[model samples]
Target: MNILVSDFDGTLTEHDFFELVRRRWPLPPEQDPWNQYWAGEITHFEALARIFAGIRSRPGELEAMAEATGLDPNVGKAVQNLKDGGWEVVIASAGCGWYIERLLKNAGVAVKVHTNPGSIGSQGELLMTLPYKDKFFSDTTGVNKLAVVQDAMERAERVAFVGDGRPDLEPALLVPPQLRFAHGWLAQELEARGESFQPFQHWSEIAEILTRC
Candidate 1:
């Protein structure tokens, strides 16, 4: 079996949910919990929860922002193509599953997802929480990406790992250079480490290449 594990926010979509949130909220560096996250003062899950709890969305605004997060239109086709060629695709996200699930369902695709659980409050607060306790639970990311990828390696004859964020670095490194696909931050970090990987702008492009192989 061939397994393809992907990150949700920036890897599967054009924009990270934080990008959309920051655009609207625009917190000052001193006040933002993200600043502490970058400084190694807090965990990734806490940073996300802190940021989301502060966003006061009004009714449809959050959903609209999610729509604007720009899930690639080709996602369904990409998943279909990969599945046809014997790839079992899964999403591993450090971000909220609320919008991730929303986007996938909206795109008319069904892919198993491992991510942080989240919901909206009656007053429109974006409430997010760490995932249920598991062996793969992470102190930083709500989901342990490295563990997820490692498990895929254990189950499959071949595994492909793809991602585009800070949390993706270690897992991306775990895969063979040829089977790793990266973009943005992950790409830059891999290049700095003198690692080799296929860079991609869209998941469809990745699907195309993987199916051909």
Candidate 2:
């Protein structure tokens, strides 16, 4: 069971899917505090709480947001290669599932997706967001991304992860040395740190590495 655990927004897709949601359901100027929040001015818990609160405040925003983001064409072929190689592929993302599902469907890849579910109310309000992400996958089944990769290693001899952002950095710290991390951010903060990562601007780099693996 060769395993590949990846992130959705920046890792697999060229766009930040969450931004699609905002575009569909434009927020009030007062609620436009996300930039300050994500820039480390506010804690993650606070940022998320405000983000959800804002979503709930605006009705029918989630569905419109989900429909706005597009998919990357290269993902389907890469996923097929992984599956053809007998690898268990999973998406470990903090983002919502609506966008991820649509993107994968467009990619024509039949694979397992692990992420938080997003629901839109009849009136177009975002009802709830589940915190399905975990810091590591060592203790559980392949639910938490790190745990999923750890679990996959039990069946496969090799494992690799691809992602971008600080959240993905958590997995980079915990994964085995044999496992590789492919960074997707154009300007990654971790690059300055001692963490080892293979920077990539596009999926072609990932395709090249997966072929070697």
Candidate 3:
């Protein structure tokens, strides 16, 4: 099997949940868990959990905002193209799967996904939890990206990884440099490390490059 492992947040969508959540509920700097995360005082999972839990929106506001977020029109086509070429695509995300699943369903594509499970509280707070017993679960970030990629590599004849965040750096580096793809933070890091990788703007571009190989 040929595996395509990708990230779900900014890597797949035009915006990340943090960006949208912050736009709606910008916590004060002193109270922001993100500050703790950057300062090494908290875990990535704790940071996101606190951020979402801090939101006190009306019953349906958050849902509506999530539903209205736009995904690339070519995403479904890209998944199809990769599948047609015998690639098994899987998503590994440190973010909540609540909106990720909804967005993918709205896009009309189905593929394997692994992310932190979450639910919206009756009062509007989004509660996320780690998959405690999963093989790839992590206490620090909710999801251990490197484990996911390693699991895929165990079954795959060839593996390709794509991502765009700090959490993605390790896994992106685990894959062969030739099959690694990066954008945003991941891209800048890869460049600084002098690692060779494909830089892409859209999921469709990745599909084209992967299928051509």
User: What's the residue-level lDDT of 192 in candidate 1?
Assistant: 95
* Span of ten consecutive residues with least summed lDDT in model 3: 63-72
TM-score, each model?
0.97, 0.73, 0.95
Please name the candidate that would achieve the greatest lDDT relative to the true structure: 1
Lowest lDDT 10-residue stretch of candidate 1: 131-140
- At residue 172, what lDDT does model 3 achieve? 96
Off by over 4 Å in 1: none
lDDT of 2 by residue, 68-153 (tens): 44455676777677677666677876666655776677667777777655565555444435553544322112236656666666
* Model 1, span 1-213: residue lDDT tens: 899999988888899998889779879898788888999999888888989988888889999999988888999999999999999998999999889999999999998899988999877878998887655778789899999999999999989999999999999999999899999999999999999999999888999999999
CA deviation > 4 Å runs, candidate 2:
23-68, 131-143, 176-179, 184-187
**Candidate 1, after superposition: displacement of residue 76 in Å?**
0.2
How many clashing pairs per prediction, in order? 0, 5, 0
Arranged by TM-score with the best first, the candidates are 1, 3, 2
RMSD of each: 1.0, 4.6, 1.3
lDDT-better candidate, 2 vs 3? 3
Predicted model with the maximum TM-score? 1
Better-scoring candidate (TM-score), 2 or 3:
3
Clashing pairs in 3: none
- Score each candidate by Cα lDDT: 0.91, 0.60, 0.87
